[model samples]
Target: MRRVLHVTDCYSTGVGRAVDTIVGLSPEHEHHLLWAGEDDPAGKGFASTTALPGSSLARLRAVRAAVRATGADIVHAHSSRAGVYARAVPAGAPVVYQPHAYKLLDPRLPRAARTAVAAVERALGGRTDRVVVLSEQEARLAARLSPGAGRTVLPNVPSLASPGVRAPQPDGPRRRRVVMSGRVSPQKDPGWLAETAERLRERDPAVEVRWLGSADDPELTARLERAGVSVSGWLPADALVAELTAAGVYLHSAAYEGFPISVLDAAWCDAPVLAREIPAFAGTGLLTVADPAAAADRVLEVLAGGAVRERALQGARDLLREMNPQVQRQRLAEIYA
Candidate 1:
């Protein structure tokens, strides 16, 4: 069997979904997942599973044990910390580092901390066989980080439950709803989103901003509630898809990102987008704004539901067709093989 060990800090719902797609496509490969913080939600679907604690010393021991136990032919890691440990794994084994996004990308991180992480990657990244980034901008950043590190871009793409059928749209009164999905933290900028939603409601009281995310901040839920924005804990996979399809507008206020999966999810659901001006969100015809007032204006324009909304929705669907996950998975298989 072709043995592969995949490592990640948390096997996120998205990461879980991606690994499921890979395994479903290639059954010939033996895949074992190791992660920090939590058990593998994705591994339940797999034929074999292993969960290990992710502490530095524990990781070293567990990885050494997993390497021996699984005889991992390829060690593929899915986050920054995992990448660091994967690189630290003994040489001669093929090591693949997929840092969904580098730690340095978060604007809230102290400059010294970001610099420290960057320096670490620069030093140890050369040891890895390859690095996979999720977007063109990220690819450029990774190239700059380690000159000799082999790298490739595997843009974020969504896979429908089935290959041939278009995803079903959920039936609902549009209600001028605007949705955002991600971890409710500073990186996602939920505070600004709450502020923007209040402004949007002032322009159109019918407008509702619903954030589907894990509330990382206890106070975030309180603040958003004060602004009349609906907050949901992580939804089940099917419910998430339904929620995305039902919304009229999708909002993204992230401070920084690699290639956001939430934006791609909204596109798949055919939700028109209004995003903060970010390089990764380019080409989608999204109303990109620099400030909260401008973002609210863009939201109001789309909620008006005339030529602008139709044009943006059609444009988003066109982009989604091109970025379907089958196209990306094919590219990923080729890169990894």
Candidate 2:
């Protein structure tokens, strides 16, 4: 069986979920994780899991040591930070790097910083055997950044539970909640959400805006609260399911992403989706909005429950088939071959 050694700095949030999905994609292969996060990914079924040293230099040294000790057939790095670690270290095995979302593409970064990040990626490109991407747009981006690395377009599957038909809420005016799930960060562009929530509230006081994840940024949290957007800080599984079940729409506002697992979960839960326009979502069948203003209008249209909502819901349903484990299993086997 092929053995994959995964290197990652993020194993607490979305990246961790992505790793879980990857492990399940190819059951015939054994997986090992060398991670920097404090919490171990319980139930991930790794052959072995190691925590990296605290410092950056130490982390790199630890990766080099792990590469030799594991005798891995493939070194798969998750995210850009670990991409640096895995590709910088000499691995006797082939290296497969998945940036999750390229840091260089983040709009918040200064042009000069983005350029520097691109240069680092180009310098390390030769060490990468393949770059795993979730979409064709990402594949083309990888081709430009990692010229020497081959591209592997692996369909992204949801790692979260489906939650089936939404639990019926108490009979009322029908909760008009637009929900966004994820920690408050620049990537999520809480500013856009704040504006959208305010505009939505002005249009209809009955409309509600809620976030399914934590309020990690104090400033953004304040803005969201001011805009009448409620934050459900890291809800329990049952509570999350309840919220998603009653959700009129799931809004994804990431300025950039590797195609989020939350979107997949939202669709699986059967909530109509409204995401911001970004390259990662191009041709994904999901309806994307140009701006928060447009998003507010779309959310209202979706909540109205008509052809627009049905069409929006249908897109996500159709896309779910691409993420079936069996489909991914076949692709993984072919790519690693």
Quick one: best TM-score, which candidate? 2
Which window of ten consecutive residues has the lowest lDDT sum in model 2?
162-171
RMSD for all candidates, in order, please: 2.5, 2.5
- Cα lDDT tens digits for candidate 1, 170-209: 6865656889898777667888898898898787887778
- Against the hidden reference, what TM-scores do the models get? 0.91, 0.93
Per-residue lDDT of 18-116 in model 2, one digit per residue for the tens?
787778667688898999663467667798889878888888887778877887889899999888888876767788999888886687899889889
In model 1, what is the error at residue 277, expressed in angstroms?
Answer: 1.3
TM-score of 2: 0.93
Please state the error at residue 275 of candidate 1 in Å: 1.9
Q: After superposition, which runs of candidate 1 have C-alpha atoms over 4 Å from their true positions?
A: 37-45, 159-166, 283-285
Give model 2 RMSD, 1 decimal.
2.5
**Candidate 1, residue 208: lDDT:** 79
